[model samples]
Target: MPTKSNNTGGRGGARAGAGRKKSAVKEKSENGNPGGRPLEVLDIPEMEGVEMPKPHDFLSAEQRDGSELQAADIYRETWEWLKRIGCSQKVSSQLLERYAMASARWIQCEEMTSKLGFLSKHPTTQKPIPSPFINIGINYMNQAVRLWNEIFQIVKENCNTEYSDEAPQNDVMERLLRARKGN
Candidate 1:
């Protein structure tokens, strides 16, 4: 059997596919296999001389077209979740804004991972893994989730107190009487 023809440096040029960028997965000749990578094709002028690009530059065109979601989206989504759980609008927005910086980081990281090549799926689950930029994104997401949970806990407790009227409070007269009696 003949080797395959060299592929052209089509869409995946300088930018890695951060979005759904399409690159020529393979090119072929009818006869036999042409060669190794782009540089190795032989005997065919049109098929030969094709150049392979750095794999890292996968998303340039994809980024240009279908960009990743902004960091604000995370806050928006999280706030939406809070609202569904009965948090007030003020509380929801506060939850989003509390970790604005963290949200930004999370967005970038998530985008990088999401936009990787289709074949670049994860080994364990056959899902895609994140790129280097995803480091910041993951960290940011974790921070926002932690902070959101913390604030939500506080709000939940407050709601319980206000609705149940179970918070401890000494009446003025009771305090005075108790003080006099040293009770």
Candidate 2:
């Protein structure tokens, strides 16, 4: 008697309806959209009864003539300059705040420099001693100057202004002073 033949075609062979169905909806495509359609844009909701604070809000009317007010003015001017130079709002806002802080620090340094002279007399030795406060004020002023320079460079580059590390030959204020003196 012949033995019954028993052989499977192959391991994990394809069968009817074994893979994904052709009619099924694609959840996502290679371009990262579902059903081959882009996502919808939504409008931002309007805020009501919320007022934005002014830049100079930190200073009172009486204190508006101080360094804090000057800082706020610098911040506003820097913001406008950055915007005119086509900087993004986020970057402009950040840089404006930084510039304002630097200006304020510079003012503080000026005050410190005025109060603390370059040299101080020794408490009892009757000799001169270098004033540590002056050194600190100088450091702060240097940092502030550096920050201002960097910010100005960025603005110049963005606005495609003539790049020059040297000072201008005829200063406007100097020319005005000469005219006034001659007349």
Candidate 3:
């Protein structure tokens, strides 16, 4: 039998002071960087006479039920938000369109799930199963979130000043609910 040694070299695993460095802005605010160089300032110029673009006609149709029309409205709302935040210049039309489509699909899935209920009968097996809309809704929601994060990252990288929401009264869910109810 070989004797077991207790000594182990510090080759792997996390060490002290490892991983990502804290934000320079946060560090400067907390402890004050006395000798460090000053942080760079970004000056984003305002565009004069900038007009909001109209979404493509495919986004809405009278024949196609509620979701199509709602998607166009959602796209307009999102555009208004970007413009209000002074970050509209950073977002592209394609990216915003993708986000709106994902969100509208998610809402459509949820509405279907509500009507269909959780359980369903398999066509071939004749056995009860979970509704397909549940999984579809989750996927659409995740895609929307991922797109939103990408948009947010663009805004975060470009904006120099701290972004704050002035109107907390206008909640997203409430607006959606009101739209759904036709209130």
Scored by lDDT, the top model is 3
lDDT of model 3, residue 9: 48
Quality of model 2 by C-alpha lDDT: 0.47
Show model 1 residue runs off by greater than 4 Å: 1-73, 80-86, 89-95, 100-104, 114-131, 161-183
Lowest summed lDDT across 10 adjacent residues in model 2 is found at 21-30
Please tell me which model should have the higher lDDT, number 2 or number 3.
3
Tell me how candidate 1 scores on lDDT.
Answer: 0.42
Tens-place lDDT per residue, model 3, 1-183, is: 765454444355677646754353434544676547775434667786677778777666553554444567777888777788777766888888888777777777776676678888899998999998899989988988878777766666565456566421133355446545655
lDDT of 2 by residue, 31-96 (tens): 366455554322334344433235655422234335233456556555554444433232345554
What C-alpha lDDT values do all the predictions have? 0.42, 0.47, 0.68
- Estimate, for each residue in 1-183, the C-alpha lDDT of model 1 and write its tens digit: 865465763444555424532222222232233543443222322223333222122212234447543334334444444444433332534444555435444544554455562235567897766455556555766786676555544445333122222211112223234433534
Estimate the TM-score of every prediction: 0.33, 0.41, 0.68
Model 2 alpha-carbon drift over 4 Å, by segment: 1-69, 84-90, 121-127, 160-183
Model with the higher TM-score, candidate 1 or 3: 3
Count of clashes in candidate 1: 16
Q: Which candidate do you rate higher for TM-score, 2 or 3? A: 3
Task: Give per-candidate clash totals.
Answer: 16, 0, 0
Backbone collision tally, model 3? 0
